[model samples]
Target: MSNQHAKPPITTTNAGAPASSDEYSLTVGPGGPNLLQDTYLNEKLAHFVRERIPDRVYHVKGGGAFGYFEVTADVSQWTKAAFLNNVGKRTPLFLRFSIVAADEGAPDTDRDVRGVAIKFYTEEGNYDIVGNNTPIFFVRDPMKFPDFIHSQLRLPDTGMRSNNMQWDFWSLTPESAHQVTYLMGDRGTPRTWRHMNGYASSTYMWVNAAGERFWVKYHFKAEQGVQNFNDAEAKAMFVEDLDYHRRDLWNAIARKDYPAWRLEMQIMPFEDAANYRFNPFDLTKVWPHKDYPLIPIGRMVLDRNPDNFFAQVTQVAFEVSNFVPGIGPSPDRMVLGRLFAYGDSARYRNGPNYAQLPINRPINEVHNYNRDGPMRFHHSGNQPVYAPNSYGGPRADPQRYGDPSWFVEAAEIMRTANVAHKDDNDFIQPGTLYREVMSPTDRDHLVSNIVGHMSQGVESFIQERAVKSYWSPVDADLGARVAKGLGLTITA
Candidate 1:
């Protein structure tokens, strides 16, 4: 409604000066040549040349819209986060959905994990929850992240994605079994961003007002319920519309059919990590619901679409380290590494002033001393820019907003497993999923899909490794079915 009657003024340059004509670029004597003397023409050309910043390293193709997150339940017992302090309190938010392994022009129907990057503009500051649609990740260690992504991307020489390469990396890395099984199953190709749930696969620590700490994971359950396309249906939709998810989201919001999701949290006491059967900080595994149950907290509704795709959606940044007073990072290795990596990558791709951008900026008045980067918008007035001054300047107050404290045991500096981890192996959870969770139809689909994807294009050697090493470890039935489907012999 704000833009309902906005034909008030003509377009202008970045400077407030009104433009004389947008139809024609200034030229010397009617199309002789572009005139360098024409400031507007030169400015336009220069800005156009540098319109785009570097795309994201993983979540390159993304789209999002403006929305609000409203607390619907009391959660003060587990978290002291102000955003979740009161029921019926509304916080402005933006949720950007993207594919993990995709080019700018890649189809929406590709079988890839979708990013669910959310930013909450609370009174405290900007808090970001960077996650994927799946509950777990391909690998737990950040050391393997770059190499894993390289395998998913195009070959160095031909610049074409090789199935062999992807399977090879995943096969050798046994920890990827749970997430790999989920990805190769029906859940991989979601019908739309609206249909799939978003999960914080990494562990986080939240402290209450009473100073009690709890390890937590976030789950945003889609109100529309889970929906997915079969491999054939996904391929057909890709051929029909490359921008299927993008158009679906925009049109749905425009038609007043706003999409919504319920926010849920799984909380575990700080001391419970010591007794858990598996590594509580492992990125490739999920906390079982039977142990840590989901508590309904809030609801998120996307009610409006971004007016400019490049401005709002493309330029937006999400950092794993973006936390408020109560929420903080955990001992998760992947999470620890991303705390620095995401912010650094965002700065390199979007410039040092990316946080100052409209979509990424916090609603709270930024009171830090950080100033004078390229395209710096606001310069603090009269106040002393540096600390240790006689003049009034914001000083650090550890009691008011300092990060929460957690006990850490001293260990030797070396590559090691999770603390108190029981039998550090990968396939147990995936085997549980195959045996106890999925139904007969789901199991059939999983086997057929793996065989179809692997045998169709992957090299014989790669396929053999994938079947015997990855699939078999997860479940013998799954491996045998895949081998039979692929017309390959299964041996002891």
Candidate 2:
């Protein structure tokens, strides 16, 4: 036999035990039933069967890369975050880009919102900005989030997604109009992940060194410039390549054509939120640039592709509640809901010690009383497991590091809609977007996209109601155009 056909002298092993023959299972005779003593075969099959972990409930079809965030302008006055303090300071970060409303098997070019989650390994801890490509969302309150996602997913009986269900939910929830407007436009079908922008759609609180608080929104403007596929183009690309966006990102980084984004923040003074014309914390609405202009603070460049896709990309998790010093959650209902949900999801999917995973671990040492669970690779080594011990365990330092919190008004815990501000109606901002922000071409595309989606498998009553309640409220022209396209007539 040729030298290439010969096996190496080194023995192959299953776990730590040497396997005598990998190609054949141990048996009583040549053709006898494979014996139960074939422990190596059992081990191989067991490992293979248990390989896959639970996929994320959302944003499952995605890819990620390693990068660094460099502070370009001084932001110390607004935030005391160590990662964003000094000019030219660089903090390592990982960015995951994903398509919402789809599983891992779905096409990347689907007309869906993209998830843009970033994890910054700061000196303090892991800071994550769990956001999406769009600046706003379908619902303001967390109570309606599950319903909205359910509407987007397949129906229980038919197991097929229905536009009627989606329209019905949107028509019932007026606040969804703003996000619906954005979705049924060029912005929904971004040409590639590299060509789209990301927004920390939820409002967050930034505290300065002097304990002054501010409400802030994060925007990651793509340096490549925003580009998108029209409805027809998006459909065509789905047939061309299901993983087009993932491939584009990987190829670009491999060839040293790194993607970058500038970090711009819209910061409202803590007191200004109380008297703003509209609710500043509303997730379904955006703070007009005129009211609070974007202030550039830093830039992020994804220069390194993951060496192992599963180890770094799939295993990496970003929790919305993972805030370091100087940052905390705002009063946004969705943000508050996600503060618990994201971390809980990670723990359930990745085990109780998910933070101990290399991708999720912070650069700094973790010294805490929390002890072992499944896959607890990191141990404290006889350290006290409870706090307030005299054996020199880690102690809380209230003097040096203050809690990132603020004062709240004392009120009765009654379930009610958010306290409204002047000009807080759902239709105003969306109407403004349709009339003032969108260009003529964009307006046409938006109308077409809406008509195309609503005309597919939607009931006539749902269609009429959507045209009258949602589209008309957004803009009269948009409503009329959509109605005309859908062959429906509405009374003035």
Candidate 3:
């Protein structure tokens, strides 16, 4: 083909072999049968056939961007992390926002939980702050997580999600009260991903260079201000545009109306966990800001949009287990459970070499003995695959690169309650949120949302049980109001 505007080279196959006309397939004769001898056509069809990969079981639909995290304040006294060692330092990061408990096909405007997964490619390593829009989650224990998520999904026989199953599970599990309140309130239908704050609300451990350990929590407060839509408004908006949230994010970054968040934290001494008013590691609970006030450290800004949406947003993996120096896991059951689950799920969905993918590859050098798996792109040249080799293999440094270690009593192995959690009741935080935290108008909206969900296709007995077991525990007045609105009798 002759062209005035000269390109670098002619079209080629995936293997760099010069390609011919891709319009037609090779055949035995004109319109007889396709020939396997056409390697170019075969390669194209095979690649296209296996193009799609398995999506996340949760947080399947998402929007992502590349950006930078700037250290605005210093916290070197608390953490030995190199990224947080100095003020005015910047770290490259990729952030992904997604809707929970839904497939990729679902609408972005669905009234569901949103996830904020940010991967910080710091010099130390890739640290993923996998969090959610809400400060707390529904289930405290990892054992209840799968069952809780199952209720929100399709039923075995009918294959349709039932409100009865969802409410029934929540009513039975009292620990879910706090998150349920957040979910049914106006916050559930956030205006857009840019408007909701992100949280490392789960407790984590931070150890300084001096071998001092402290419990910490992170909050990314949205600079754009938190906003939400009422039920009426959300329904109307969904009808007009189902991908409203995704479009809002892509357009916002494209127009340079960049969104930003302040990264703040709550720090408590390691020994303080024993006598804290609440279980500090509970995922269903929040550390009161009054008791543990926020301390600003850094800020995150998303200024660039991804050129390839599928590569950056869909394939980018953020595991809960990815931790770097100066940071380590806690006794939080949910976090512990996810440490295994997140990595395992990613391997299955993205293949074993998923980490080697460009979107997931760390900018810093990655040297490991892990070798010989499917799709392995990098094999260190002529290096011993095992450790303890005389050929200059990388080795762990206990003194230089060690993580902080804390002692847990031998008797703490079982599920039995200790003195700290003996009287740890689930109703405390949700009640405080209802009675003292929310405004009068906010309470009204919360009640309205609860009634609307409970009133849908659920049996009268389950409805009554849900109100009495869940809502009544939060506030008797709220339970009574919900009963009245649902036209149900309030017995006992």
Q: Find the candidate with the highest lDDT and give its number.
A: 2
- Candidate 1 local lDDT, residue 211: 83
Can you write out model 2's per-residue Cα lDDT over 1-492, one digit (the tens) per residue?
A: 349877766545555767787688888788889888788888878989988889887788899999999999988888888888899999999999999888788889998899999999999999999999999998888888888889988889989888899999999999999988888999999999999999999999998898889899999999999999999999999899999999999999999999999999999999898888889889989998988999999999999988888878888889999998899998898998888888888888889998988899999999988887899998988888898999989998886578776568998998888757988899998999999989999999999999899889999999999999888988888899999999999986
Model 1 over residues 1-492: C-alpha lDDT tens digits? 468687867778889799888878777778599777778888888999998898787889978999999999988988899999999999999989999899999999898899999999999999999999998998888989999999999999999988888888988899998998888888999999999999988999998888889999999999999999888898998789999998899999999999999999999999998878889889888888989999989999999999888879988888999999889999889999999999999889888988988999999888878888888888897888888678878888888787876777797888865546774579998998889988887888788788877875788887778788888988998888988888878677
* Top-down TM-score ranking: 2, 3, 1
Q: Candidate 2: which stretches are off by over 4 Å?
A: 1-14
Task: Give candidate 2's root-mean-square deviation (CA, Å).
Answer: 2.5
Per-model clash counts, in order, read 0, 0, 0
Q: Residue 467 in candidate 3 has what lDDT?
A: 79
Q: Point to the candidate with the largest TM-score.
A: 2
Give the local distance difference test score of model 2: 0.90
What TM-scores do the predictions have?
0.95, 0.96, 0.96
TM-score of 3: 0.96
How many clashing residue pairs, candidate 1? 0
Give the per-residue lDDT of model 3 (tens digit) for 134-207: 99999877888889889988899998979999988888888889999999988888999999999976889998
- For model 3, give the RMSD to the true fold: 2.3
Single out the weakest 10-residue window by summed lDDT for candidate 3: 414-423
Worst 10 residues of 1 by lDDT: 416-425
Model 1 TM-score? 0.95
